[model samples]
Target: PLAIQQTISVYLIAYAAMSIVHGPLSDAIGRRSVILGGMLVFTLASVGCALATDLPTLLAFRAVQGLSAGAGQIVGRAAIRDLFHGDDAQRLMSQVAMIFGIAPAIAPLVGGWILGWAEWPVIFWFLTAFSGLLLLATWSWFPETHPPDRRVPLAMRSLVRDYVAIFLNPRFQRLAAASSFNFAGMFLYIASAPVLVMQHLHLGERDFGWLFIPTIGGMVVGAYLSGRAAGRMSGDALTRIGFVVGGIGALIHVAYAALADPFAIPWAVLPLFLTGVGVALIFPILTLAILDMYPRQRGSASSLQAFTSLVVAALVSGAMSPWLSHSTLYLALGSASLTLLGWAFWRWERNVCQRLPACPQETTAVEPADPL
Candidate 1:
């Protein structure tokens, strides 16, 4: 179990480290090229994983997979901001999120089904085929959203400086922290899935859907509602509501963990549904807000945001999950704590915006400024 957890953690660590580069690289070159290159690398890494003969070899390949896997998500976000604005951007983001939410729910089931007929290597082979198709699709259809005229010059000094400036911005700190913590709240459960499902829930590998389906169902529903609420509602209002829903879910989970005698199905997992909804609701609004902060440096901003989230996710997976997975109550407390911290950061950002005239409003887009 520890080895399995370590394997997952190493991938996330590599992913978080490389996340910082993918965005700035896309900013320097073009979104399409970066994405295609990353997908190609990911496909090759999957092949390596499929063929790896030893644990060390498999871990190395998994790290490579992680290194390349983040390009699409990080760069794709910048591309979205490049092409769209305001409500249109929000709607598109939500739609994309709704589609993306399906993967987590379906992935385990697919892997289990594949395992029924073939060995574990086949899973990596399947990933290779999947990423290969994505590479072809991207090559055939994806356009260069960031034109050459708007591209940032590739310089290590400039990259470090931009990252420092973005990372240091008070608004960026709060927004990125808020989004990262919120996601980590739910990710705590996901990271502990082996123990939570197999040991605590006393279920088999095929029963992962019991946890994932409810969690992702809430996310999909929330994403759809977020898209619908795009033009009609204020981003602040939506964000506040999302936090409230997530808070309630966390509280409910804690209460259930405390009260439930033996921890049954459906009842135990249902709260995650609300938490997922909350995550989806606030994600698009916060992401767009971060991207809007540095119009010329959206790629950098997106990269930093993704890095922050991925780092937090890595910690939760590698540290917190292992510590808390032994006790249902402890896991509930950890999640609740993370959600509360996220809400506090969001509230702090709101207060700062209200008090400062220069601070950008959450509902409106900010004018482009120097990357610094």
Candidate 2:
């Protein structure tokens, strides 16, 4: 599994570099074709993983899978936004996310079992088979969502314009940066967890599953509450609330490190639990707000989100986490710092957008995002 995380990081890097290409490519080639191509790549990568006997091979192929996975994620998000707009789009995307979320919840438990009962290669075989079935489903039933009439050329001139628009949109960049920081905190924890828990704490993989349960449980709570409170609270308000909560949780973790109690189970587990809840609230809201910013290029915007988040996470995992071992304070403070950055960005974005013209964020005093 540590190898898997490293491989996953490799995929993240590949996705960061390449996901934008697929979105526009889909615009030209058609959604169904693009989806099928991504699925095929994913399946082939799975097979490569299954056949991999060394870390390098697995990492390379996992990079391929990451690229494909990134495409699938961006394509799915764009396709939904294409099908609907505004609040309707948000609801639909959440439902799609719910479907995808189920797998991660199940995947950890299943992967733990595989790690327990079978060798690592078996895990790849499972992925290979699962991806193969998905490929079949895509080929059989998925119609082209991007009709010929809707096709937009993936020209370099347009791509540059598209990205420039995203970066230039101060609101989009802030939101992207906020979410990226949020993700960095989460991914930093994930990268560190295997070693921190398994190697240092001597917890078994199955125990790790139990630990994962709480974080997801928190997320479920946040999601449910956010949904119920949707009428009374703006998504930005929800994000603010999540930021406060996540920041507090991270601070607690950092505090434990400062006190030389980083090894205490409560210190590790509870903060992660809180972090999960905060992220659940933050994710749906942040994503909706950003996706709302770009009507024509939701795909590209999503690519940017995934790109920034994944690159930060991957770099932190590969370089930073490994460097902090044996220094509990560094590990905790380093992780907590990302949360602090995210919280600051969120507040700043809330303020700056207050000065915009025709601010759609008629939350009165609330800030609005820049153009698409």
* lDDT per model vs. reference: 0.87, 0.70
Candidate 2, residues 153-256: lDDT per residue as tens digits? 67677677776667677787788788778757755666676676676567887876645666666666666666655546666677778887887878887887
Q: Alpha-carbon error at 342 in model 2, in Å? A: 1.0
Per model, state how many residue pairs clash. 0, 0
Q: Give the per-residue lDDT digits (tens) of candidate 1, residues 179-259.
A: 999988998988788799998999988888898888888999899889999878888889999999999999999999999
After superposing candidate 2 on the true structure, give the runs of residues whose Cα lies further than 4 Å from its correct spot.
1-9, 53-60, 95-109, 137-144, 260-262, 354-372
> How far off is residue 213 in model 2, in Å?
1.8
The best candidate in terms of lDDT: 1
Question: Could you estimate the TM-score for every candidate?
Answer: 0.94, 0.84
